[model samples]
Target chain A: MLSPILEFFSSDPKDKKLKKAVEHIIGQKPSNIMLYRLAFMHSSVSKETVAKGYKESNERLEFLGDSVLGMITAEYLFKKFPFKDEGFLTEIRSRMVSRESLNGVARKIGLDKLVEYDGNRRTVLARTSMYGDALEALIGAIYLDKGFQFTRKFIVKSILTQHFDIDTVVSNNPNFKSLVIEWAQREGKQIRFDISEEGAKHNKEFTATIYVDDDSFAVGQGYSKKKAEQTAAMKACEKLEIS
Target chain B: MLSPILEFFSSDPKDKKLKKAVEHIIGQKPSNIMLYRLAFMHSSVSKETVAKGYKESNERLEFLGDSVLGMITAEYLFKKFPFKDEGFLTEIRSRMVSRESLNGVARKIGLDKLVEYDGNRRTVLARTSMYGDALEALIGAIYLDKGFQFTRKFIVKSILTQHFDIDTVVSNNPNFKSLVIEWAQREGKQIRFDISEEGAKHNKEFTATIYVDDDSFAVGQGYSKKKAEQTAAMKACEKLEIS
Candidate 1:
């Protein structure tokens, strides 16, 4: 532990910055800063390794971290809802580990700030998934640096249980269509969702409009009818102030 | 350990049958027959536990086993391909854990004979997935009954390495369209896939026809254009003996 502090003064500016970032993200001092460094190394700037292989990027780490996340989440669900059916377990698990949820977690942990990448304009535009991918790679690094038991505790106590609100996640249906329909049914109000397709045969767009009691509530467009309905329902939910 | 053998001889006929099946599947003596029994019990015949909850079917076990499978597969891939990129790892992992692969593994393990489910005509149609689910549940039961190490050995040695042909799997592309296109390009043959939509708007269908050298080679159908193309490509591969 003292080594890190001692090295802090002697370490280069970049190393010091990385150490700080690692400390902030994990809430624990990093024992293997190299692994953490690799975790933040994006594939965009991937170099060659000694073995003529590409310099390791967060992708491999992301793969392992994804499994670790799934296992930990499954264990949590098994214990938390002992009597719940598999459907409930699967639904809750999906909510907890969804891309949107992970993106939020990544933002909260400031992973976007830590990532190192070199990219072109098109690549940069496609890197909306970078933060979440970095977060998973961080987890894989932690698992390797800290071991499985420590990683499990770190994730359960610090990440999932600490950062995410369980109640809100459970109650908040990402399937906005289902939520709005339930709300409409409870109030005995008529609700209709109309979806239409437009554009050329190869590149088509779907538009969905929601009507509540004969009043146009919201309109949304997407590449698919389901996505369009979801978008429209989300807008309707925002307008009506219903979860 | 001897208790299982004694119980097999003196127990009810059903318990005897279950024990026999369990032994056949795991290639070991049954230390706890109850867990194995639950592993094979489908939700269709679900009863009530003392807690008034639906007597746990293989669902929870399957959930746990799915994670176990993923983790084990990740570890295997990590060790097997030290320098391989994440994309390679992900593709192989998906291939190994795919439903078709799992179902094939389940069938090889004779899960078709062991699972006990009470179902009507419609439910029976869905039993195609039951065999694979039971196989996963059985894995979960082993993890609990024996330990992680033993479960790992069971999966890696008894199931994956022993039964699966790694070389064939690696060479075979699940993307039939890609495989067929590559073959067509090498052979200097012109090929085209034409897809059309059919059926009701909501319950839509897509059909695809593959033409090689301006002659119809194969026809296939699916719910989506991409799937239909894939189906047609698969048929073309079969007919042309191309992949």
Candidate 2:
């Protein structure tokens, strides 16, 4: 086990830039570099797996890593704010794990150089989620290769402790849905969110409108209905000066 | 480290019902009974922690275990349905992890006997989600006691392989929101979901309605807007005979 782990990490003893960088980023020597290799494999390339019936992409790992990341962050917040209710914890969690937030964090951690997407990396459109997905895949790879405790430690030492300020995150209010509803109730007005799917199957966009007393107050769009509703609520809050 | 692990598992030389049941369920000697103790602790009896200003409940563990469970299931589904898209994967996952399903699985696995919630176990109203939360806590405990590999094996062998039929879960469409929208679109009818908050801050209930061509068609309620939308969609589907 030791021999294979070391050999895999030191395969290119002459030039181990990827391995060295990965080790530095994750704060440990790589056990199975192949997992890390797959972490860098973007869906665009979608390289075929050595396993006969498998296609290798970071998507599955991304999905896994997403949950891992959420758990770590949830644990952190749960400990830091012991008195905070579930709603507050959940809202802050959303802000911390949002695509925009993750994208920014990925860039801050210099994941742009490590990703393997099959497109120009410099385009503004491509930059929308440039390294966010790869970062998640890396977390998944680390979880798979290192285990949960090690992954949790990496999230704490490498990501949270080093990259993010937990205090700022906890202090901010991100639950616009609650805010708009509260405003509506206080003013004795009824508010409703009308959400509908409006796009292609794979890239479906949901449109949500915040309706005040059967009239449209604000409109917002997102990849999912919940996301669209949140955006729409934020827009309504802003429009009504309640934000 | 090995000695300490062994000692922790074997410390309680007496009433080892918890340890025995856990060992039997997990198919291995638990490394830490303390973790299992925390797993059985419901919020009603939230024991204070040794850590200053910290309270111990199964909540944090539940949060962690949820991610562990999600990751394991996601990996399983990803492998099983390599051709399926993200939407399909997400829909199938919901069915597998729904409260109703979890509750049933928990009862089937005898978590009812192991859980330590401070309530009458015979009450039907209290049975709404008695064992599901404890089941998650148990998974979290197993993860903490034996680590991710052990947890993964336990989920696969003890839970999925022994308990659930993956084929049935995959084949059934659980995303009523999607189904209702599809049916409405095929019929050229304008469909909308009106989601609004109702009730107290802590005991908040969300109400959702399915509107077809500006007419109220169905109503559903849940703890969150997304769940409310889903319930409303399911009701609409049933009402229109599209489900």
Best by DockQ: 1
Tens digits of per-residue lDDT for model 1, A32-123 = 78788888887665555655534567878989898888888887887787787665576688778877778888888788788887645336
Q: Can you write out model 2's per-residue Cα lDDT over B110-220, one digit (the tens) per residue?
A: 887877765643474365565777788788888777867888888888777677888877667567899999998897999989988844465455789889999788887
Best by TM-score: 1
Candidates in order: C-alpha RMSD to true structure: 14.1, 13.8
Clashing pairs in 1: none
> Per-chain TM-score of chain B, candidate 2?
0.67
Q: Give the residue spans of candidate 1 off by over 4 A.
A: A1-13, A16-31, A50-55, A119-127, A174-243, B1-33, B48-55, B119-127, B175-243
Chain B TM-score, one value per candidate, order as shown: 0.65, 0.67
Estimate every model's Cα lDDT from 0 to 1: 0.77, 0.73
Reference-based TM-score of each model: 0.65, 0.63
